[model samples]
Target: MIGLVLAAGAGRRLRPYTDTLPKALVPVNGDLSVLDLTLKNFSEIGLTEVAVVVGYRKEAVYARKDELEATYGLKLTLIDNDKAEEWNNAYSLWCARDVLKRGVILANGDTVHPVSVEKTLLAARGDDRRIILALDTVKQLADEEMKVITADGQGVRQITKLMDPAGATGEYIGVTLIEPEAAEELADALKATFERDPDLYYEDGYQELVNRGFQIDVAPIGDVSWVEIDNHDDLAKGREIACLY
Candidate 1:
């Protein structure tokens, strides 16, 4: 499986930092960027090939592509998301659907987490599961977080930011392991999701999969130190915990 990163969104809330750089390029640990950390984690886990979906200020990534490849010792496959500035990540993810044939361990470009998160997901992979998300049950869920609801054997029944926080089992930390078996259906679901509403997130696509009778399971990342950098506050917190990772 290849490492897939969705780094296309234009983080308007991040202003000047994102003005010329994609959110993934925002440095968390000294000179190491969020993308750097992800690549590092993927490398440690022996994924020598990585695909990054880039848009918005994609030139920044292009400029550093060679260097990133050399540093991580991995070949880079850069996928372009033409609608990145206008649409949400449902489209960004769909843009990389072609690469899904090989399967992927997907990481949100803006998330800062340790290699343990990746290791946990890799360890949990099995033939019975097609899509496995890294869920954080320990974190306090808010309306803005992508919350999840699971059943005894039904696996993930719901995944959306609109769900009531009280009923949620945990928050989806934007990391997912998509098996090759799930690729076509996931691509179709994402296509339907984005075609219906450009503003929909990829988590909505997961809901579409559930709606179609497909079970998407969740693996709890038990008390892990991680941050999804959105605004300045998240970036600050990301920097603080990134060094520990």
Candidate 2:
């Protein structure tokens, strides 16, 4: 299986720090950037062939691509998303269609987790299906976090940014294992959405798939230490969790 890391976002929320560097390159624990940890996790999971989607500060992200390959002794593929400024992650994924066709483990660049990603990859079953990692209810979740609502104790009913506290069933941890057929369907849905509404975000693509009655298996990751680094506070919290591993 291939590993696809979506790191093309401009990270406007990250502000001044991202103004100088890609959010994926932001230092998390001393020398280790979020990208570093993500690549390391993929390596541990035996996904030696990896592809990174880059946009903002593409040069810096490209510069480290070779370094990661040399350090991990793995092949690294780089795909540029020049329209990152105007599009969302759905567009990024759309740009990596070839890689996705090989069946990919999709991960967000800013997310950090302690779970065994390889185990999760191996746990995936069924054709034309998706396995989404759903985080348990935490003490608090930011408004920007994506929430997943599941039904029948098996499938995802909807995925959306937290708009109401009472509506959220769990947070989406940004780790997903998808079959090639499902990836193609999602890509088609994303393309249609963007064609109709150019400003649509990536979460809208997920909602489109759910609305079409696709079966997305909800994998509950309860108590699994994971954090998404979007700002300085998240960086500190992610480091704290990383220190425990």
Off by over 4 Å in 1: none
**Clashing residue pairs in candidate 2, if any?**
none
Best by TM-score: 1
Clashes of 2: 0
**Residue range 102-149, candidate 2, lDDT tens digits:** 887888888877646445545655644564554555636657778877
Give candidate 2 misplaced runs (Cα > 4 Å): 137-142
Q: How many residue pairs clash (N, CA or C atoms closer than 3 angstroms) in each of the candidate models, in the order given?
A: 0, 0
Candidates in order have lDDT scores of 0.94, 0.76
lDDT of 1 by residue, 121-215 (tens): 99888858999999999998888999999998899998988888999999999999999999999999999999999999999999999999999
TM-score of each: 0.99, 0.90
| Residue pairs whose backbone atoms clash in candidate 1 | none
